[model samples]
Target: MTDLLIRPAHHHDHDAIWSILEPILRAGEAYALPRDWDRERALAYWFAPAHHVFVAEDAGAVRGSYTIRANQLGPGDHVANGAYATHSEARGRGIARAMGLHSFETARSLGFAAMQFNLVVATNSHAVALWTSLGLREIGRLPGVFRHPRYGPVDALVMHRSL
Candidate 1:
C-alpha cells in the first residue's frame, strides 16, 4: 500500500483509465452505467470539466482511479460527490479505501463542506462497509432503486459525511 501513488490524472492516462473502467461497467453490478458504453462516452464522463479526476499508480502502472465533483450546483455545490474504480486484478489491495481517504482530503481542499453518495447500491456490501468505516452514515435508503443484474431490483443508500 505504501507503494501506491495517488495523483491527478493526465491526458495520457485515458487508455489506462478506460482499461480499469470497462470491466466494471460491463459487469453492471457495482455501478449503474451501461454495459455497452464506449470508451469515448466513459472517458467523457470521467474527464468532464467539473470532475476532478485522479489515478492511483503502483510501480508506475495505473491500478485505480476516482473522480470528485460537486453533488449539485449553486447552494448544493458545497457538498461533494465521488465515484471510484479499480483494476479487476487489483481488488482486495486496499486501493479503494486509500482512494476514499484521499478523496475526502481532495474534496475538502476544494472547499466542499461534506461528501455525499446519492445512489450506493445496497447489494455492494464492500462499498457500504468501507463508507461506514470512513465515517459516512446512511442518511436514507431508496427501496428498489438500483436494478442489479443478478439481484434484480435492490435498494440504494444515500450516504454522507462532513469533510
Candidate 2:
C-alpha cells in the first residue's frame, strides 16, 4: 500500500493539483465543470484562498488533491462541500479514498455537522460506489444535470453523509 500524507496545500502545490485535475476536466467525465476551462480559471476556482483545499503527497510528489468548503451560506453553512481528483496513474491505490476520509475528518474538526456532494456524475460509477462504500447516500438525482463530452447529457447524484 502507498504511504500517503494528506496536508493543507501551499502555493507551490498548485501545479501538482492541476496535474491531477486538468485531465479529469478535459475528459469531461465525473465532474460538472466546463470542459474548455483553462488552467488559470480552474486554479482560481479550485484553489483560491477562500476555500480549504488539501493535497495528498506520496514519495515526495503530489498524486491527488481535494477541496472542501461550506455547502452554502448562512443557515446552510453547517453543511460541508467537497471535491477530489487523483492522478490517473494513481488509480486503484486508494488515494481518493484516503483523501475522502481525510476531508471528512477535516470537515468534522471544522465543525460541519454533515458533508454533501452536490453533483456526483451518474456515469462515474466508480465514484458513486466509492461514496456509497464510505457511508454516504444518494439522497437525490438531478436529471441531465451534467453534459458529458462522451456520454452526452447524464444525471447527477447528490450524496450526503452525517459527520
Candidate 3:
C-alpha cells in the first residue's frame, strides 16, 4: 500500500477503470448493473456527469476505482453516495479499504455531511464487512430485494455513516 495513490480519474484511465469493473459487474453478486452491458455503456455510467470518479494507482497501474456523488438532490444532497470496485486479480490486497478511507476524506472535503449506500447486496460479504468496519452501520435491510445471480433473491442493506 505504500505505493498506492488515490487520485481523481482522467479520461485516459477509462480502460483501467473498466478492467476492474467488468468482471465484478458481470459476476452479478454486488452491483446491480446488467451483465451483458458493453464497455461503452459501462463507461458511460461510470463517467456520468454527476459522478466524481477516482482511481487507486499502485506501481503505475490502476488497482481500483471509486465514485462519490450526492445521494440525492435538493434536501438530500448533503449526504454522499459512493461506490468502489477492485480489479479482479487485485482482490484481498486492501485496495477497497484504501479507496474507502480515501473516500471519507474526499467526501468530507466536498462538503458532504454523511454517506449512505442504498443497496449493499448482503451476499457480498467482503463489501458488507469492509463497509461495516469503515464505520457504516446497516440502518435498514430490504429482504429479498437483490436477485443475486447464484443465490437467487437475497437481502440488501441500507448502510450509513457520518462523514
Please, what are the lDDT tens digits per residue for candidate 2 over residues 23-136?
A: 999898877788779889999999766589999988888999999999999999999999999999988999999999999999999999999999999999999999999999
> What is the lDDT for 43 in model 2?
90
Q: Candidate 1 — what's its lDDT? A: 0.95
lDDT of each: 0.95, 0.91, 0.94
Error of 1 at 87 (Å): 0.8
Clashing pairs in 3: none
Candidate structures ordered by lDDT, highest first: 1, 3, 2
Residue 26, model 1: Cα distance from true site in angstroms: 0.5
| Cα RMSD to the true fold for all candidates | 0.8, 0.9, 0.8
Comparing 1 and 2 by lDDT, which wins?
1
**Candidate 3 Cα deviation (angstroms), residue 135:** 0.4
- Per-model TM-score versus the true fold: 0.98, 0.97, 0.98
Q: Distance from true position, residue 73, model 3, in Å?
A: 0.6
Scored against the true structure, residue 117 in model 3 reaches a CA lDDT of: 97
